[model samples]
Target: MPDRPRHYLRQQLRWMRGTTVRHLWWLRHMPLRSLGFWMPVVEYPHLVLALLVPVAVLATP
Candidate 1:
């Protein structure tokens, strides 16, 4: 696990990028029941939420 917020986000982004690329072909060609097809469907939004943490933090007074 990452010790700092920056490190965590970096790790998450790396994971998101790597996963997307690794599964790109499968995501494009695999059926709905396939792991690759479902992975991004769940993961992208989760990653985007992770990316919004800083904004959420900064928005608080």
Candidate 2:
């Protein structure tokens, strides 16, 4: 392959890698942006705690 095309391809790959890094960085700290559905469930602690007791009892040794 020619040098210019190979260099361009490498640059494009680098740009893609940079974009992927930025996306992952955002995901690591900005959890709500990715998990909108899960946020509501987390807000209701009492209901969750009530349900967990039965499930835990069922699974106990």
Candidate 3:
């Protein structure tokens, strides 16, 4: 019973590590210029929403 939790934790960590590595590799290979333009929206999503809300309200009929 004690070993079961340890085994489960190891398996979970392996999965998380693999997922993180895969995502990092993908990001590393992606085009940096396009990513740069969108990075701010990802980093400060509230800013994007603040800018969009007014445009959305004005465009509505």
Which segments of model 3 are wrong by more than 4 Å? 1-3, 32-61
Off by more than 4 A, model 2? 1-3, 31-61
Instruction: Give the alpha carbon lDDT tens digit for every residue of 17-60 in model 3.
Output: 89657656656765766764445436456767889999999999
Query: How do these models rank on lDDT, best leading?
Result: 1, 3, 2
Native-to-model Cα distance after best TM-score fit, residue 6 in candidate 2, in Å: 0.4
- Candidate 2, residues 1-61, lDDT tens digits: the string is 4369888899889997896576566556666755643444454566678899999999999
**Model number with the top lDDT:** 1
**Candidate 2 backbone collisions, by pair:** none
Which residue pairs in model 3 clash with each other?
A: none
Using alpha carbons, what is the TM-score of model 1? Answer: 0.54
**Model 2's TM-score against the true structure:** 0.45
RMSD of candidate 3 to the true fold?
10.8
lDDT value, residue 42 of candidate 3 = 64
Q: What lDDT score goes with residue 15 in model 2?
A: 90
